[model samples]
Target: MSKSITLDQPDQRNLLDRMAQGTIGKPVNRLEGPDKVSGVATYAAEFSAPGAANGVLVTSTISKGEVALIDEASVMGMPGVLAVISDQRMIARPAQGGAGEAPVQQVKQIDYWGQPVAVVVAETFEQARDAAKRLKITYNADDMSDVVLNPEDADSWEEGPGTETVEQGALPQAMSEAAYSVDATYTTEGHNSAPMEPHAALAEWDGTKLTVHASLQMLNYNIDELADSMGLDAENVHLLSPYVGGGFGSKLGISPDVAAASVAAMQLGRPVRVVLSRQQVFQSVIRRTETTQRVRLAADADGRLQGFGHEAKVTNLPEEEFAEPVTQASAFLYPGQDRVLKVEMGRIHRMTAGSVRAPGEAVGMQALEAAMDELAEESGIGPVELRLRNIPERHPSDDVPYSSRRLAECLKAGAEAFGWDDKDRKPAQRREGEWWIGTGMATAARIHNLSKAEASVTLMEDGTAVVATDMTDIGTGTYTILGQIAGEMLGLEPSDVLVRLGDSDLARGPGSGGSWGAASSGSAVQIACEAIREELCDMLGCEDEDLTLKDGFAIHNNKRQSLPELLNGRSIEKLGKLKPGETEDDFAQASYGAFFTEVAVNAYTGETRIRRMSGAFGIGRVLNEKTAKSQCMGGMVWCIGSALMEDMMFDHRDGHLANCDLAEYHVPVNRDVPHLDVIMVEERDPAASPLQAKGVGELGICGGAGAICNAIYNACGVRLRSFPMTPDKLIDHLPEI
Candidate 1:
């Protein structure tokens, strides 16, 4: 049997709180941790097929043009060379889909520098690599003359479709009359998702069906994308990603590896395997769009904001519809009646621009919070105090009450825990040896979202339970959380509940993007467990309110009965489905937090080093204390990288990515990070979901980099508007010791 619930109204039952197993929010170890550490888990490429041939993709070297010809005969005679597939279906940019459908087939028209044009298959990996490099390709280059390689070219911009300009009141008048104001422009470079697992796929075709094992996220949507790209029915495509190393939004859609492998398998009538090199992953995957933002804020003498504006410019490929949403949290983060927000997109010859990590707020809030720091300085108020005063009671643009907001609490808690001093306002006054020390703070916010999901829970006759869903873990602890939810509801130890995930044939979940996996999919499991509880009540001939299940036994009227005896050799299975409705939009819902950091700036070298960091978050409910804290810690690490080292460099003339591998690109390593403190201020919002939990995966990175940037300015009195805060940009502007 199946049970469905649409979240149109607040669910006040709070059933997890009443469960007697007492394992819902505890720090349970990951169910699959041993498997992962012991090398027993098999990732996508590890799966073996009977007669698999290796394939290597051939990428374009030009920015934009049509493929004139691919000399297939050039590579066919090579040793062990089997086939060369150049089908148009193998090159669709999977992340640039329109609405709910697959993106248009790219055909032979090259859109970017590293776009995949064809694949070379052979008997072995070395043969395929040799053949792909030697295969000759030609292009007309007619479109290259008009290609726009720079996003800053003013004439190449267009109003992005589906992006809107928000206006509430007269912003110009309010800005001019305010007692204090700030207007500044900031820039951020592009970034890669850089998941641990490079995209890899193995495909087998049986003349009537295709089975592929690929590294991916969101199998529900990926199934449709792969099926559409291969011109096959969705039912005929069996995609399995049972063990994914990591996604980080890089594997959210079907990449060239999956497409090329599927296409090659069908054409050759044999199994095929495709694996992308690390350089290929960096150059071909979707990147986070670089941003240029102009933020204006008007505040009274007391630092109460009266006007706010954030105008941003982002870039994408000509046919790509996804422009990084740079102002997602700006409209409601502060109380400003006279507000305006706009996003302009420029066409450029680059990799497809799409979501990376937190997308909008990860880079957006870095600029927004830095501008707020400027406002605090101009008004002679503390940065924390200024932000505390501008906390809006209602959403500024939507005029709706908040479901649950704890931004103020996070600010206060973080300040107290970090030992922030509002009285020490002067810069360059505190010095330790050759370093100047200072502290800074910034607010964090990520919009709450819910998606439709389905999961199944089955109670067996052996006094155990099983939870099955297509949701992927992606190193975020999905396997443990789902097990906890089922165990909490069924009165069993978390270890006793078996959790099977990352298979397409199971009940489809909402997948792991947008930080909604735990809450959305966990809700379905909770609902299914609730149905099993009702069945037990019926079997025992007792009312629902009188039953208390605990320790693998049922308790009613001060009597206990073993579950095996009550089951009587019968198993119960139930499917639970969740659908979002009016409640999704009825209230302004977001997870709130505050980040604080301390840093030391070297006077001579103009280098910044983090000393300490702390963050306090209010993400509706905490499913696992250990995982939640780990997520916050991970976000803070990303913050350190974004503020100091991470930057994607591109060649100007040809639009090729300059840093095509980790050796050239930079990320925060162990030496760059400091001790991090994470605090979870757990709360519940009935309006958010049936489980009363919100997304926490991306919350840690949203606006966190601002804290590090502001600390740099306070430490050396240098306010640089550019991102990464490279030493070259700071060396010339450093104050004399």
Candidate 2:
């Protein structure tokens, strides 16, 4: 019988805590850490096969046009060049994670810049690159390709995914009646995710069967999409992705390299490999869209918000139908009845905009919290106090009670830890040795999304356990946590639980995106382990409470039974899946937190440095102390980058990026980061899952950038409406100290 669980009510014991194995919540080092550091782990491009061909993808030079001419004869005869394929089958658009509409595969015309135009295959990677450069290609450029977003283009704008009136309750009237209000507009520059691993795919075909080793997050979803892209049955495709360097959100779907390599291998009847250069990864991969937001807040004398309006404009390709869901957290982040939330998507030819990191709230909150700081100033109220006053008793928009919310607690705890009262209230008040010191804080909230996931656990004759799932560990410490879950359930150490992941043959997981990977997949693992425990209980003729499982032994009435003996000449395996329950629809479920940051600004140079950072996050349960802390710290560092460093620059003339490589597109290095402290606030939300756990991965990013941005303002008394408050922009705005 198949086992299943829908998290409706809270599990009384939550298995992990009740088991008390001293392993589930402990600080466990990654099981694969040694392999990763020692170079034994094989990534997608590292996999090798005999007689394999290397394929180089050729991207388009023009922003938008048709392939007017391309010389196949120019490169087909080159030494070691096997084939120069310009087939449309090699050109499929990227998938937008989950089960989004598959992109059009065969397009003779280009809609955006840097679209994959063709590919060249050769015996060696060097030969393929050499031949790809030799091919002569030209485009019949079109004039309509020049599309740019304008604030005045309101006449052409359409309502986003949700209607404007869905949550806007007499917002205009409330704004007019309020005693105090702050209305401001903020714009943010666009950026893209740069994982340590550039996308790569290795494909091998035997007869009609195909196997692809690719860097991917969702295995089953990718298998279906890859099979569809190749026009083959899903049964004929196998995707193997065991370890990934990092995904952020880039590897959540089918990348261009996967399709090109698969097509080349199928055609050549041998293994073919495709690896993207850093430039190609930046030019073709999805990006966090730039946004312009007009946030208006109206509050009473007591600093209680009366009205809220958040209208944002974001962009994507003219044909692609995905835009940044910029107002995702605005509907419920604070308490206000007369609320208005909207998103306007502009159809532009800039790099196709899609999910990068915390898609909606990362940029959205940067704009919202800045306005909040402005509101606090306008109302003559403290910043943290104003946020506290606006905390909602119920859902601000839907009128639903929260499943579990601790924003106020998080703020208070973080403030206490960060010395909110100790910091001087006056902006630019304290300066020493040409440095202006200041502190800032912001509220953090992110929607807790859950997807269906399945896993299988097998008990071996040697008393060891094995957990199998198709989830990829994108440096998020998934392998360690999965073992922790099984070990907690089976009464064994995490090391004794051999966890196999990133293979399509294993049970399908939700595939690690949207911060739902751990909660959803862990729930499935819990259900499978519970099912086996129940079977063992029945075989022992004892009730669940009557049995005790510990250290590879099951004891009832103090009579011990070896776990391997229970497996006794039988294939003891249980398959399980977890589904969304009634609580999701009944409540507004979200992870909540607060960020406090201290910064030192150069009095003369307008340069800013983050001095110290601290955050308190309420993500329900901390699965692993070390990994959870790492996730928060990584996100906080991302905040440092988003606030002052990272920006994706494009040529306004051609719509192509000028600084497409990492050498120019700056990310935060070790020197750019400072001291970071993370506090995981304890929460046990039955509504989250059987584990009573929510994700801590993206929570820090929701308002993390805003905290640092607000700090820069406090330090130099400059309210930057635009993002990446780079020193050049600050020099002109800074006060004459």
Candidate 3:
């Protein structure tokens, strides 16, 4: 028996026609916009249920030491306090071991400042907080520890899964052999996501079942980790994150806040909410790891690349394991003869660092792209021309043909739009008072990633369609995009489609990460909608070639029937799953962009201000122009912050982060940004997927910092290698030019 084949569009109509007639490219407002803007949208911290209590965590003051004692009697006696749980009692049944080589248990000796030592539950948030602060604890400090930030200290650490070790003095040897080379070291400070809503969770125990409302990027993974931590069956635990304000990358996994909240709820036999204070938010949740990058580029006199190498060392917590930030973009950016990229991890006694925004590429580009700009200078070529000369038509690492590449077009368009050809090239030549004006450009790229996702679409008798997937919005406008996909595929208006996401009970989705939210989830929705259309065609006894779906009606042989009439009071349902195919091995899929920046630097005070910025992207088949543009603009702003102000300062005296608050660790505000423009080149690649769409979230940010840093160098003859490129760093060495 051959399987029944279904095809609803055998007549062959242009896909763009169908998309234009539906909601695919329309600028539809977010479905949850009102709820979010009006302050009614519930975050993890705002979740509440009956019999709910409050919880607070106490962190260790010492960076490295063993806890000698924890006297919690005073804290437990406080008013409204329910219980105080210490690490000693919780260690009776340890959590399951990890999947890889890293240890699964919590650190016995405090390896970093702000490590959680105990948690307190009370009837009120104020009580829990007050009690937590009053508890006394002592630590046996160790003086043998030393902070690890210099590359020289990396020798003490061994090579791990995601890190590479390089021998001393080997970098200079590689740089001297090439006809053209740029040897430079760049440093970036640690920065936190600082989401408007801090990490919070509300956990409840109903008999043997556990339910948690937490803010996380991956719902299924959160459930699995939560179950494992509590030693409960996976089915017995449920996780939900309906909405999130913003999660650049901090909320990728289960944080300490979720585990502490669940443990308190289970012990108290009542619902509990744990909301970390702003101060605690900095120390408790994950932050971006600090990095020192040394990049060398070896190119021929004509600027044709010969060899390229990047060596980076990142600070990691002694207790926590993390991947290095360099070598992320080295795998596939440019064509070269010999490319050697190494990433080394140096353990530092600080808060555990994790992903923030684009993670590796965010920092990697700051070094690699800047080196490209320097190489352009040495070769006496324009930055855009230099990039064009080195453009890789295919992946250099794996030797696979690109599914689609338009980076050259992006560079040309962006340069033309930003007036790069007419800008001043020499430092101090176009000075206005104390400011010197200059322009710079860089290129960006990100892999088009897709994962296995399942979605369900139900057609109701009222001609409405409901789509459900476990994907999360995370303030990236996922709901609107998913709705657009479903509406386009099912031939319905945007208003006629409903979207439900961020619940483990729904059909599993790819979850939001690696810029794959829109492409993967939208593809899933498309598959489910196609299944529903096929089912309707079968029930109407119509041949697939003679059918057309428009305005909630199916047309066959010049006869039109409303979806309601075809349903006959029966609802049609379909399930769609996206599975990996041979295309993964056959082709390399990536999204590319070109970033351009114009900056004006003060010659006297060394203060640099971004005058104007623009970016052009070749992200295959933009689903929504407005949202895509917004994503690009947001990334540019983030890169500006990284270049001028964002940095996390560590107190080398105690291995504690000194600038733990936003006031001390600055990000870009409206006053810091200037006029910006974003252009998206619309192209389609059939090999990417049925939708021929790629991820755009991270591409906008990939090379942003590098462009700004290069512009600063152009405006002033002085070369500032360290990030946050502050005025103090450049003031002492201001050039006379």
Against the unseen true structure, what C-alpha lDDT does each candidate score? 0.88, 0.83, 0.76
- Expressed as tens digits, the lDDT of each residue in 115-134 for candidate 2 is 78888999999999998888
Clashes (backbone N, CA, C under 3 Å), per candidate, total 0, 0, 0
- Superior candidate under lDDT, 1 versus 2: 1
Per-residue lDDT of model 1, residues 1-737, tens digit only = 98899999978899899889999889999999999999888898888898899999999898888899999999999999999999987964443242221234385988788888899999999999999999999997755557788777636676665677898798888899999999899999999888888899999999999999999888888887888888888789888887788777788888889999999999999999999998888888788888999999999878898999999999987766777778989977997899989888988888888778988889999999999998888888999988999998898998889989889899999999999987657777778998988888899999888889999999999899999988888999999999999999999998989999988889999988888998899999999988898898988888767888888999998889988898999999999999987888888888999999999999888888999999999999899999999989998999988889888899888889999888878888889899999989889988888999988999999988898888988988888788989889889888876
Best candidate, lDDT: 1
lDDT of 2: 0.83
lDDT of 3 by residue, 430-546 (tens): 677778887778888777777777788888898888989888888888888887787777668767888898898888887777798887777777777777767777787875555
Model 2 bad stretches (over 4 Å): 10-13, 93-106, 144-155, 162-167, 422-424, 569-571
RMSD of each: 1.5, 1.9, 3.7
Evaluated against the true structure, the overall lDDT of model 3 is 0.76
Highest TM-score model number: 1
**Stretches of candidate 3 above 4 Å error?**
1-20, 87-108, 144-155, 163-177, 319-321, 422-424, 543-545
What TM-score fits each model? 0.98, 0.97, 0.93
Residue pairs in collision within model 1: none
